[model samples]
Target: MDPVKRHLPPLKTSINKYNLHAKKSLGQHFLLDPMINQQIIALAGDIKNKTLVEVGPGPGGLTRALLDSPARCVIGVEVDQRALLLLNELKEYYPERFKIVEHDALKLDLTTLCDSPRQIISNLPYNIGTTLFLGWLKQGAAWDRMTLMFQQEVAERICAAPNTEFYGRLSVIAQWVANCAIVKRIPPGAFSPPPKVYSAVVNVVPKSEQPSPILFKAMETVTAAAFGQRRKMLKGALKTIDGVNLLAKANIDGTRRAETLNISEFDQLARLYAQNNNL
Candidate 1:
């Protein structure tokens, strides 16, 4: 059957049959619109014959989208018991093409979730989405691509530019390692029990030249210090931080605020800090 034309039960009906309700504490918001889900999957570019990992496959709404794609297989990491039976039904439907790992996505190493050459695609749990992405950014380039959904504000921070209100540690680190962009802005109505805020799908591809885990940590340290006092001048913000002296050493202006510095400049700071501290 053609992926686009494949016959599958409606996601809403499955949710009803499984006695599933979106958990407020878990930050669950099912993207129950089939076409919207399909569009989200397409943002990953191409998966043909590769495995796709989904972080929170609530109600299998987006799971259906992944299965309907030409991807060779889909592995969903889920913690909700309410979703297991419904996902099991999906597994039966796509016996050769689907698998489910019953566990908390945040507790497991995503790289170990499957073999190499995998790509991650999911409507991530809003609460842990940033935390998970930060981990993925630190890990080796285990996956080819990652297409994820995050709260619109989170998405903005991930893709925000220097000097913008949304830009912070997230913008610097994510931009340092990968090409980040928000490909779609989704309305609240797109989800079941719609959230108060809108959502967006982000596409991130790792750069060929990337930071080592140690260097990445250095960057994290500096950004935390710099943005921790975001409104203060760089000299004041980083005075107690190791990277402060590097401003004069690297010819960076001490009068500028943290948000005024770009990714490359932050890299310079991280590198300088790492070298001096013998990290």
Candidate 2:
């Protein structure tokens, strides 16, 4: 057995001993499957000397896997006070390497806490997964890569293609600045308090070269107006933003709906929108 495992009890044992049942209010579906946990960590690529930042690590199932790996350290952002107590016990096994911050992942600026050559791997709290992901993408190469878990439906939306049913503002914005792919699918049963929907892990690597903040903000605005009324053509859906004029400037067909437009087209539209509005 690894020396660390000898010191720290398994995650299930710790959970039962602490009576830390999953909390629905916190979206706490504990990842009890060790195999799944290890697999998710593997998707982050090598962590030999890399920092691993895990979010919402309730009961520390995935946290244990990260400790066992050759990672230089594991920094867990946990909101549940009960989970932090359990995680605190891990400090004994890896006194210098494991640290827990009792803070809400959403409110914390994760990038500022660690240095580069880091990777974030987590079975995220379902309620805030997408919002956190969008925030992370905006960090502009703060970390090397991100391997995150989300609902199966959300996973498809992240990696969806143009004209597909799953494609929308999320697909456009996510793909614009990052290379996203579905790493694996995890059934609902994998989680201790299984979520109603199946889960899937996604790998997101942000592009080293990204558009300026103004262009990105413009993209966000354009996608919101475009996909806000997805069924309507560009002319009617984008009327508030001068949709027909914007489309003509971008050399795109005004008859097309938001779902039919690709990321490149959206990028062009955002640039034109910014220029037109002098934004």
Candidate 3:
């Protein structure tokens, strides 16, 4: 019997009893589509013996699927107290396989939560999803893989290439540290109380070694400045930074706009900024 099927009765009962409704303020759009949930688990691949961490597991739909997978253990971090009761029930049914930590996922120490070779699989809350991902990246190659679902727009930003409108700071930073791509796109209707925008699942595998730390910092600073005034040319946008002789020092055309520059150009500017201090 499928683990999820076996637990269906209790799961449904809890939802009915609690009258648990997805909370928009929490960015909760519960995924009622089992097939889609299963597909997400499949994308993660061979969870058997792997530890999976799920965030905002409202009513454990994905949590149930994770248990059905080869995963040896599953940990769910949820902020909704109403969801906690249902998660706790699932934990009891699969004592050795499931664990629930009732807390805001963003506030928790994810690295210390499990042993190495950890994988994160979550249909994250839309509001904090990007912020949470940036936090994970900063951990410096903590997880084996991260299969996360996010608002389609944000997903596009992560997978977008330079020269595209979607490409920006997120694309640069994420691609610099991880091999990222959108695995699937989900329609808004796939979720309960359907969200206004579609969602996409993205797979991010951390690299063995990252770019120079100094370059990374500079890239961030430069991108923030450049993109902040996205419509403006580099000459005007980067003028705030001292010694920012856009065309000569950065090797970037002063006439070009922020969106026109690629990751390499950004890195070049970053390296120059770090060395010159004046720029």
Best-fitting candidate, scored by TM-score: 2
In Å, residue 52's CA in model 1 sits off its true spot by 0.3
Error of 1 at 23 (Å): 0.8
lDDT of 2: 0.88
What clash pairs does model 1 have? none
TM-scores, all candidates, are 0.96, 0.97, 0.91
lDDT of 3: 0.84
Over 148-226, each residue of candidate 2 has an lDDT whose tens digit, in order, gives 9999999999999998989998999999999999989999898888889999999998898887888889999999999
TM-score of 1: 0.96
Q: Which stretches of candidate 1 lie over 4 Å from their true place?
A: 1-8
Model 3 off-target regions past 4 Å?
A: 2-10, 211-215, 277-279
Model 3 pairs in collision: 47-70, 47-71, 48-70, 48-71, 242-278
lDDT of 1 by residue, 195-274 (tens): 99999999999988878888999999999999998889889888877455789877899999989999989999999989
RMSD of each: 1.8, 1.1, 2.3
Backbone clash numbers for all candidates listed: 0, 0, 5
Q: Which ten residues in a row have the lowest lDDT in candidate 1?
A: 2-11
